[model samples]
Target: MLPDQSITEELPKDRKQKRQPHSAYLRRRLMTLTSIIIVSMFALEAAVTAWYDYRAQLANLEKEAYLLADAQRSVLAAAVWNFDFDIINNAVNNLFSMPEIMQVAIRYPDGEVIASAGKLSDGAAQMRITRPLLWDQGGEKEIGTLNVVIDISQVESSMLVKLTERSVTLSATLFICLAAIYLACRWMTQPLEELTAAITRLADGDLEQRIPHTQRNDEIGNVARALVKFSENSRLLYDLQNSLTFNVAEKTRQLKQVREDSAHDNTVRARLLAMVSQEIRSPMTAIQGAVMLCKNGLTGEIQEKTLHMLHVAERNCERMQKLIEVLFDIYQIQNHSLVLTLSPVNLLKLARTQTEIWRNKAYQTSKNLHFESGVAEAWVRGDEKRLQQIIDILLSNAVRHSGKGGEISVHLRREGALISLSVSDNGPGIPKKIRPYLFEGLARSDEACSDSLGSGFSLTLAKGLVELQGGQIYFESIAKEISSNSTLPTGATFYLELPYIPAPEAAD
Candidate 1:
């Protein structure tokens, strides 16, 4: 059997490097990642807790200093008022019992210390607060001032103890989590490793190997169940693969033979069309000339009725000649020999001239034709004769498909590096059934219009000619619905665009 060759290319280049076994990698990767994430989260929490705790300790130091100073200020104020030095000294000395208040002193406003406690070491980091002592028994009067200093250096050490306790607790929790995850990964990967070995053995034509973990209800069990069924169908798949390989080879051979036959048929058909068109053109031209001479009274005097019949015959003969030429062109295109004669041609002029020619034909069918363009010269590099032929096909198709008294219009314009020509008709639009194959070498008719007959590959020829000149052609139409009331225009418009070229004189 042929391998699925694309699988090798579709694998990642990184996968081509030396790699660990899937089972071990799965276990190790899962456990390691889980361990890292748990550790990182715990560490982040510890750091944030330590930061807030440190800030809180410093804030408590400041708040306690103020609180303790406020608590004893009244007693100190009375002591100072009564000129009792011993009571003031005792009140200031009691503040040293609070750990945060490292130093406390009562001083007179003149900077003389009345009483103080807690000696300060030189260059010790501390926070100090000062407040004036006021008498509360009467209107406020400053007797003295109280100052307190708080030790802030020990805040870091206190926070460190808190963070250390949290770290120890988190470390124990993390160890337990990592151990659980490791055990779980081992349990998961063991069965997976067995399944991997089963698949590898199955791939190596060991159809009878056991599939593990089917009794447990999990994805692993589901995989084992599926593998159990796959093992039973292993021989069937092998047989089918051999049959499919044979079928694919047979179908490829048949397809190649069919394409060869189609190419041969196309060649034969093109040659027949060329031979038939050449055979019909000579007699068609003679008949048209004879009809013309008889109508002009050169083949003896003809009656008025005979003259009208001759005109009809002459028109039919002209149409036939056109069909022959169209066939020959189709043959040339099919045989890939439709060579284009490139030159700078004025598209506007060609459209106007063809419109004038088609106007006479339109008038015969009670249809009016109009030509409009803004530019005097719309230049494009193309075969003028082929371009004219494209215009003729578009105009003729418009006139034929339009109802009697319907308006036909030929519009041309130059639009920056491209020239556009459109032929429009206010008739019952192109038929729905044939729209899909409109430009696919199919005969077309607007049966609703009831004023025209359709034959030949006019649209297909127009498409071929337009594309050969480096142009695009398309059409738009909407058929009026029988049951709906709408103001939609039931008409068809054909548009052709060719790459515009600078005028000959402008180029010079």
Candidate 2:
């Protein structure tokens, strides 16, 4: 309802809307999941192909090596039988001509090397094949052994190149798959994203937003349909709430206008009362003077009955004059026309003076009035007249509320940089229901009290005057049970606090 309060209520929604959308999360997860699956499949395929191809190549190379060794066995056998060193050398040299053959050796039947070509080193990447040479075809005649060492490093190098190519292809494939998945996810969730945006706008007070894909027959379209329904409902609800709010606001505005009119009327009445009281007081003052003279025999010798009547007329005039002054003070406070003449005044002296005046009045009412001052002289910055009025109001309330034989206490003390004054009464305390409106003009706890007499305007004027002089007034009350029969003793204490100002130091 309040501007600041409305902003506070809407701030969390604003912050939540500012966060990343669900579509972004969906897109990222889809792309990542797709890429991982594709890459894993490619890696597995590459690994299986490479392993199978390497094993097949190794088997083929072994078979070819055995064939080459068999073919060279006959030549090597005939060469060794003839004891022809040139033939053995030629055969071995021809075997070395094969690039795969790293070494070749023809040995005699007695284990003596007849001929050898190329170097033979023991390395894991080489394949070796050996075959025994036969001299007679029908009979087994041992000649020599043909040994050939083939280099497998070239095969391994070729396989490594193939694997590198596959790796490059796999990487490219993964990139393509990622791009496709991203596009696919974007297409699938695009409607949802739009719906979300529309919802966000609606939540942000844009009730006109609508989902655009409600006609499609898919899951997204189903959601869109539901969202459209929600939007319609929300719009209707918003309209209803808006209408209610407008009505309430209209009523509130009317109520405020009425209150303002009432305040204006009260102000006009106070001004009128001030004017009438002044006019009546002038004549009443003259009448009182004449009556007092008649009672004193200054005009003529008056009878006892006439003198008693004069006395009654003078007292009535005094009461009327006091009521008029109170009305004038209320008018001044209501119009904000009460001006304070601020000066350094001794609050202790002011409290003592008002206490002595109220003490006599309390005594006449059979109420005990006591004053306690913690400090001899407590200086404060305030208007003396306003301060006196505050004390008077508190004392009057205490004496009026406190029953006969009740005790009323006034305490004044200097508390740090402030002066505290309190008036307490051992009588019925303020009722809880009336505490809220206690300081309002013409508001009285006792409804039967005459408006022209104890209208509670004094306390309101006192609070206004105190605040105008940079002071505060408040009260505390406690209800205590006195006996098994009596309900409780309602007692109240009113406190006034004003800034303490020390006297100016004398110049040296």
Candidate 3:
């Protein structure tokens, strides 16, 4: 499999897989929540209403009973004072005739029965009462009782009739309110249903869908606005994706044409490389032979300056070969053809080695190169070549950006299962306009590229390679006022954090 296949894979588009509309979900959830609240409120109100009405009925009954008792008291007192038994019986009969006064009775002092009226008819029972009277007997005042009977059923029936009528009316009123509530819920839910249907259509590739507008500025209005935004965003994203796909397809066609042209170009380039290698190698070999012969004094004693010139040429040739190797590796990495023979690598050691190699170069430029580690060993499973390439790229960037006599700091720290390698330089930071695309190909700061420079593909290629090996790269550049370094107006820091793996044991 290609090294970058996983990174570039596009997820499939399935409209049917969309979630239910937020408005519908919101409406349903709101409706349920409202129902729960309303029911709870009404239930509490009903319990209180029932208790208050019952207490009022009891109070009314007690008041009416007291009034009846008082009226009966006067009649009995008049009859006793006049000593007219017939008049008392007649008054008692008259009181029982009243529909609410179901029964009446009276008793004289010394427990003798005086008079009685009415009967326990229709399952009604009589309620009993008493009054105290004083009578002289011998030398002491004696106690006697005047008994009265009132029908409790009479009071109960009257109060119950009134309460029943009120309850019937109240039940009808409650039913009407509940019916209205249900209808209002249905009417409100209609708009939500309409919004849901429109959104469903939109999800099914109907970008032209829209919700009906309302003058009401409630939650419904908010929902309408959100749905409209969602539809517009979906349409815009759909159009943008199509535009991108079309551009990609067109570029692919052009690339195919370029590939055909590049085939012939590659043949020419190969021939040119072979010829150049031969031309360069032939001279270089001849010069080496001549130098050996001259050292041996085959022709004559060579001057010190001439011998030194030959040595410089040989050194340049060796440097050119190493540069060619780097170029080939970069090409393979760009084409996504480089296969990594991944193994556990100790990152601390890698950083130490790269720091040592670049320290000399930094010294040559009158800059300080510093390497510090918070860990003795940090291991990762990755391609050694690619990892080395990343370290070199970061170090080279730091070295190039660091001012003369400035400092470049390379720090490695282990955080859990990952290792963090950060390279920071005391140099002018990236510009705001360029920071967004800083890692893209062929992008460079003017100051750093003034001296000997390579193609501006290293950072981009390094980022891609690190990501391919399950690592990430990020950068931060602080402003001059905020930064402690006075030599730089601003400075940039790059971080590469890679997952760590333990090293394999040597064969026993």
Candidate 4:
């Protein structure tokens, strides 16, 4: 029933469950702590018990020696009084026969020995108790003394045996208590270790691994139920995320396909328009020539009415030719087959020339054209024709957007390692509704498309051409609704910057 009694009993095979590494480590710590505490208590108790037992054994032996001396004092006194040596020797021998009495002696008061049963031992300690013989029957006169020496060596041997027994019992109890603590720690930590592993699995996205021991009504069970809820939520979120990703990928694929189809359709339409324009151009050119000849009286004299009609025909023919040229240019650019003849061109001269040409055109539209140059000669390497065309587009756009009598300015300047030609107009700034799609070149409204001289892709084509020549183009514009507080201008300023070619490189 006690721990010491059951210490040697073997544990049942079923109760000895295999411990997990975590549980085993925890159990080892618990066992070590329990061992320290229990062993300390055992040591203290054993020391106290041994100390008391040793003292009691020594005291009992000493008490018995004194009592033996007292018992023999009367007889020794009578023997001494009668001068009987035989009785004295017999009593001394009797006292020595007992184990505690190592030696017994009867002696006269002058230290002469009458009788003694034993000599002193070689190493055994002795307690000598002396009792004097008094002949009180006569006049209480002293005759002889009895000396009993107790052998404490016997008490030491007895203490050794008793201490050994106590130590054995306590050691057994300490071991069993430690073993029980170890088992308890292992049992309790097993479920905790399982829960820890389950948490790791869940964190690693192993949502399918079932958490064990959920049915128990304990703290571990509460945690298990909470984990179960978290797992369900995680699974639901994972499913939703997967579904959302699938839908996004599918939508992106559909968008890419649609864009490919649209690009194909645009390519085909550009080719068709180029073909139709080429067909219409020859006849239109011939008609313009014939009308010019008749109006000049080379064929015959013409009335004023016929002359005005011929003038109208010439203007319409020019408009048609310009539209066709724009369409063909758009097609060539779209197919990436547009050829550029690279050369070192004087950018300032080019800007001046284009400004003059557009100045005449702007005059016809009642818009004033102004030109300014910040550098004497700005050189850039590019297709001279394409550069001229880009300037023409910007100038034409300025003229078209400008109100009557609105001032248009063409500025040419050197911008560190580049040459920039900017054209601006003092007209209403770009409209807000088309700002988002402004560069895509869909004018979007009649107000934005006031001049239909260009294809819907004029800005787009200009941007592509600038990039092809290693240049950049950007613009700044305030919509018509906002008033310009700055002194610069109210309309748009489009900048076309090309890599500047040094004069030395140009010469080479």
Candidate 5:
């Protein structure tokens, strides 16, 4: 018959369908602020009222003392002139009867008591002279004197009653005013409280929650409208952001697939080229051996011209094979999937030989190719073939890019533990914008097109080969503005620094 306990616990929302009113919350907040303000005002008002009451009591006592002095002058004059003790005694008795009169005494200028009525000590005039006293006679000659001691009890009592009445009225009025302020504050803040709750829900990811805008020409109405606009804009921006993220993710996935396919193609091409090179070089090698045997005339004499032709053909064929092998090596290096063939080499000699090889090409281009070395000998521990490739690539680049009738210089120096080799040419310099990506393989710029050897592959492969041998390569190029003269042609300079090994003889 009854629902389960867990279901019942969760079912309270159905019974209390109505949400809590914003007015109730606002009323509580206003009451708290109003209570603080009322308490502060009441404290200030009480302090001021008590001060005023104390001052009024002091003034009343002063006024009464002066009136008693005037009354004493008349009564004492009549008693002395008429020689009637009854009049003087009756006047003193009346003064004593007054509640403000604590004590009264009549004294001569010489401190002699002529008459006294009320409680006082034998020498009370001297002891009780803290409050100012008045004399009956105003002149310097004091034939007789009268003194009145005014009591302040009645004035204090009356002032207390007045202050108490004022306190009750002031308290009642302040309470009423605070109550009115509390009601007004609650009314003004009710809509704002509801709007805040709605905004809170929206901030917590509930886009559907929104403040209701009531039409009225007031700040509260304007704020409600502005909030509704903000909610709409936020919803649109959220959806747009999600769509952009999805689009970017999809594009990134496609780019990854393209890279994979390109990688696969490169692998297939490399394998096919390797097979073709092997097949071609084998027959060319056999022909060269046969040609060499005929040139030697083992069986018959051969013409000198025919022998010269065979030598040229063999050399050209070898060059082509070497180019193919270099391409294959570069690809393998890029894939990080190749092992280097390491050997110790005399780097200075290697560089000299490569420079001589490029001298003819540089001459044909009308550029002077020169090689200078300060090192007597420098040994390097690295792959001889790879290191030579790096040197050849740099030389070939210098020869190809140098201006006509320009100088191309190659310098090798054994500077401390480093073997520093530099190849610089006089030509149009490399552009600054493309300099950063110059060593990156397959990175080509329009300015590089000026050179016939500008495949953008040589520097990339050279850098890799040098690094594989535990060396570094960087280049610097001077601008045309710096090298203005045609003879001093602006060009790029490639600096190669490699670790040098101690010679076997030197070590011993």
Candidate 6:
């Protein structure tokens, strides 16, 4: 199956499980933001409350210290003025009875310490206030001094208890607020969760899934509606895709059938051509032999006009015989039945021999056929008859295309591990219109020479024969002047290459 066609297959079990849903991410973000806000609000409230309580407690403590001094001043002054040591001592002891009082002291006017009570340590908390005793109610005369010291430990303990209680309350409120916010967020995002699930199902190829909250008027509802539309569109697309797949498959089967029919037709055509060539060749060979005998005057001397006529008939017969042979060879190649009798042969000598035979023919006309070999000898493994046929085809093409007074050249040389035989002609080059299909059977140029009895079978036969012998054949054409009157470009060179093999050394 095609890669695209396998998309609907089940994904790996681990992959499906590993994918985190969209709702999970949204919930995580919402919880994190809500937690920060709740924590910040609690921290701010606790700080503000602690500051306010601290200031209030300090103010109340200062007021209580002043009030205690004011209430006890008359008692302390009278005791000190009467010179009663017990009364002064009792007054100091009474002041120290209060939990906030850390110490108390009474001093005489002469700077002598009259009384002192309570522990005075290095780390003891103390709030001090001094009041002077007056001799009369006018307070004009100073007699003695009363000093009271208040401890701040008890106040600190009270403030700590209050802060603890407020902290507990704030914690409970934070918990309740967070719970409410989480519930509200979950409720608001429930539609989104449903939409995400529907989309997942759609991706998994379940196009029937529908979002449940599409009727509600919210952003999530709009998304749900869009998801529903998407599911519908997906279903339509899947149907169209299936239809296209079925049509493509049907067309592919039809194409395969057409290809099979064409192959069978080609086979039948090749077989028919082979049978016809075999039938025609036998009688044509006999006719050629009889015509040769008559032309040689085996029976009697012939008239001049009759002899020319006989010669014409003989040549036509030979041409027909050659055509038949070419048709048979083509049929054999198309059927993959052309077998070569391979042997070690000198390629350079072979090329030279074929060139000489064609050179004599070229002399009969006003054409020049030149043969050049760069090496003393070049050897290869090939079928001699088949190789000769290829050379003949190439030379014939060069001669026919060159016309009279034209030049044709054949060259042989060793190139790397291969032997190359090249035939070139300075004629009107192969026409552009027919060059593409030059080696295709029966391909002829638009301006084929009227006097030439050339069929397009020669090059195709040559190419097939060369390839069958493990060789390659190709050609190059250059635009050049063929004549003075017409400067139109024309020239072509055909190349044949075969694997080189060294000939056995002569015995010493």
What are the TM-scores, per candidate, against the unseen true structure? 0.55, 0.63, 0.41, 0.67, 0.65, 0.69
lDDT of 5 by residue, 315-359 (tens): 766665555566666667766876888767898889999888889
Question: lDDT values of the candidates?
Answer: 0.81, 0.79, 0.70, 0.80, 0.71, 0.80
> Higher lDDT: candidate 2 or 3?
2
TM-score of 6: 0.69
Could you give me the TM-score of model 5 versus the true structure? 0.65
Q: List the residue pairs that clash in candidate 2.
A: 429-490
lDDT of 2 by residue, 1-508 (tens): 4434434555445445544334544566666786788689878989789979988998998888787777767777877778878978887887788888888888766778777888866664898787898899688798888888888888898899999999899878877887887797787778778988887887887867767786664455556656665666677777889999999999999999999999889878978967987898889889888877788888877888888888888877877777777778777877778678998888898999999999999999899999999987888898888788788889988888788899999999988888999999987666677678778765565622642354376777788888888889888876443332576556889999999888756679
Tens-place lDDT digits, model 3, residues 357-383: 999999999999999999878888888
Worst 10 residues of 1 by lDDT: 1-10
Clashes of 5: 1
* Candidate 3 clash pair list: none
Q: For candidate 5, what is the lDDT? A: 0.71
Off by over 4 Å in 3: 1-327, 479-489, 503-506
Worst 10 residues of 6 by lDDT: 5-14
lDDT of 6 by residue, 1-508 (tens): 3333333332233235443334644576677687768787877878788878877876787788778777777887888777777877777777777777777888888878888998776775556788787778664789888777777766677777878887888778778777877787787667678778888888999987656886654445556666666676677778889999999999999999999999999999899889989999999989999889998999699999989999999989988888888889989999998888998888888888999999989989889999998989899999999899899999988888786799999999889999999999987776666678888765665445464454677787888889988899998886433343675457889999999998967779
- Superposition TM-score, candidate 1 onto the true structure: 0.55
Q: Put down candidate 4 lDDT per residue, 291-334, tens digits, no spaces.
A: 88988999988999999998988888887887777777777877
Off by over 4 Å in 6: 1-39, 51-157, 206-218, 232-236, 292-304, 373-379, 413-418, 446-454, 478-486, 500-508
Q: Order the candidates by TM-score, highest first — what do you get?
A: 6, 4, 5, 2, 1, 3
Relative to the unseen true structure, what is the C-alpha lDDT of residue 14 in candidate 3, on a scale of 0 to 100? Answer: 19
* Poorly placed runs, candidate 5 (over 4 Å): 1-65, 71-88, 97-102, 107-115, 119-147, 269-273, 277-283, 287-309, 335-350, 353-369, 374-385, 392-409, 413-461, 470-505
- Cα displacement (angstroms), candidate 4, residue 453, comes to 2.6
